[model samples]
Target: MFKRCFLTLVALSVFATVPASANGAVFDMGEQMIEISPIDGSDYYTGSANAQAQVQNTGGIQRTSFKQAIDSLEAAEVEIREEYAVYTQKYNEAKGRYDVAKAECKALKNNIKQINNRLKNVEKTKKMIFNNMPG
Candidate 1:
């Protein structure tokens, strides 16, 4: 139970850190209001006006072609597959070691039980011989 809880906490921590390392910072803008007003008293403007607009680029989005997107996804998939293979191999090796250790533990426990039984029999024999000796 302790091991299970520890592993769960570790998994949660790993998952939590993953999103924290994302590209952009998180902004919490609560209750925003925007109002646009024209300088003219009239509702509509008839004259042609020269307008210049400047946009601050925050590197939020990247425009990519379909082929580029596909290639990126394929590369990600290849990396995922390689990582999976490495982790799977490590898991298999650990499992093999665990199995060997479990078998050795079982054998050691059995040997201990046998030695305890022999000790009990030896004590009983000693008691019997003492009782049979002349008083």
Candidate 2:
């Protein structure tokens, strides 16, 4: 019962996250160069050859046909954040379940100990009775 309530609370919290800000920075591409908007907190993409050349020479940046590269990076960032949330929620639930199981096991161990103690006392009492009995 307690476990169910705890899980419900966790689920509600996880699903209740507010959507990310819609003002995601946009990327603009130019001939032989990539133009990224919101650069330095403004919405202008300078069309300079040196800048383009610099971006192009960089190995990974150069690989994609400009448009796909920016899109891929943006998608990866969003995915990373989303996957992190999912994995974290699952981990917390698993940890909670493990804790509950551990507690149950401890309780069982205590019960076993108590039973053993009672059995020992019974054996001692029986031995005393036999010792006191007339032959």
- TM-score, candidate 1, is 0.52
Cα lDDT listed for each candidate: 0.85, 0.81
lDDT accuracy of residue 71 in candidate 1: 94
Q: Model 2 off-target regions past 4 Å? A: 1-67
Q: Estimate each model's TM-score.
A: 0.52, 0.48
Task: State in Å the error of residue 45, model 1.
Answer: 12
Q: Which residue pairs in candidate 2 collide? A: none
* Model 1: residues with Cα > 4 Å off, grouped in runs: 1-64
Cα lDDT tens digits for candidate 1, 1-135: 999999999999999997786523432222133354558868876898789687767444443466678899999999999999999999999999999999999999999999999999999999999999999
Q: Against the true structure, what is every candidate's RMSD? A: 19.4, 22.7
Candidate 1 pairs with clashing backbones:
none
